[model samples]
Target: MEDTQVRDTIRSNIANKKHTSDKVMPGFFLLMASISVLTTLGIVIILVTDASKFFSAVPLKEVFSTQLAPLRETPSFGMLPLISGTLMTTLIAMLVAVPIGLAAAIFLSQFASDKLRRLLKPLMEIL
Candidate 1:
């Protein structure tokens, strides 16, 4: 009877421990997730503040003012060059990425053998 009581007590203790651990696990995960979100928000705020300061130093007149005719001689903002350069770089990057990405997809889906696929899938997952 004493042995039975000891066994029952041990079983109950283990069950209580498992229930407590399960409850605590989600709280721990929530804490980690909240920390990650706050860190990301902090980084974004810092970047925005830095960029705002950079843009604020430039004269608004230079940014928004339109050029007059050559005879009238008003200041030109000429932001078009910067816009065009950004577009050109973005287009070039897309052009370079699309073909390589498509080729990789095709090879993985159509050409790779089953064993190779299994091996590569795990490798890609680890990466």
Candidate 2:
């Protein structure tokens, strides 16, 4: 009887409890979602409009040229140098990181206990 009365009282208290968050959070989330959608649409519209303007005046070949400077006097727009530099950096980083990451993964997967693996997996990902 005491247990039944306690449970009923707790249930009534929970049923009556109301938070500001319960009222405001749904509307806040909806507003944020709409803003994100509007922002994406606006960016796509702007990019298409400006891309059409740029491509009308410039040839696609010059934009993708492998040579950094195609002409002596003309201003260069070639992206090969930037692309190559980025690729080189990525290669160097991978060369340094891949072996270490693979060794750690092998240790975690092959040897670590289930509890340790579960705990470390998220920590390693964060690092």
Candidate 3:
């Protein structure tokens, strides 16, 4: 009878703990999600503030113009060349990465076992 009482007490304690955890888990997850959202909002606010300051100092026309003359009093802020360079880089990166990624997907789908595919898929996503 004493052993049964002890077991019941232990079971009640575990049940209470599990119930408490179940109640708190959603609140904990909400707090974490709120923190992430606030952090993202803060970063976006900072970026917009800084961009506004920059645009205020530099005219919008100059940013889009394509007259880049170095060794001058005020360097030209032509964004065309930079934008083109960025686009080219993105194109090259996609050209290189897409084929390999597709090949990996095909191999995973067609050749790899279910367990190996599951493991490698997550590993590739992490990488």
TM-score of 1: 0.59
2 or 3, greater by lDDT: 3
Query: Residue pairs in steric clash, candidate 3?
Result: none
Quick one: best lDDT, which candidate? 3
- How much lDDT does each candidate structure score? 0.79, 0.88, 0.93
* Candidates 1 and 3 compared by lDDT, better number: 3
Candidate 3 ranges beyond 4 A from true positions = 67-72, 101-127
Cα misplacement distance, residue 112 of candidate 2 (Å): 4.0
Lowest lDDT 10-residue stretch of candidate 2: 12-21
> Higher TM-score: candidate 2 or 3?
3
Error of 3 at 12 (Å): 1.1
Per-residue lDDT value at 29 in model 1: 100
User: Against the hidden true structure, what lDDT does model 3 obtain?
Assistant: 0.93
For residues 1-127, what per-residue lDDT tens digits would candidate 3 score against the true structure? 9999999999999999999999999999999999999999999999999999989987999998886664589778888888998999999999999999999989998999999998899988886
Question: Model 2 segments beyond 4 Å from truth?
Answer: 1-23, 69-73, 113-119
Among these predictions, the greatest TM-score belongs to 3
Candidate 1, residue 112: lDDT: 97
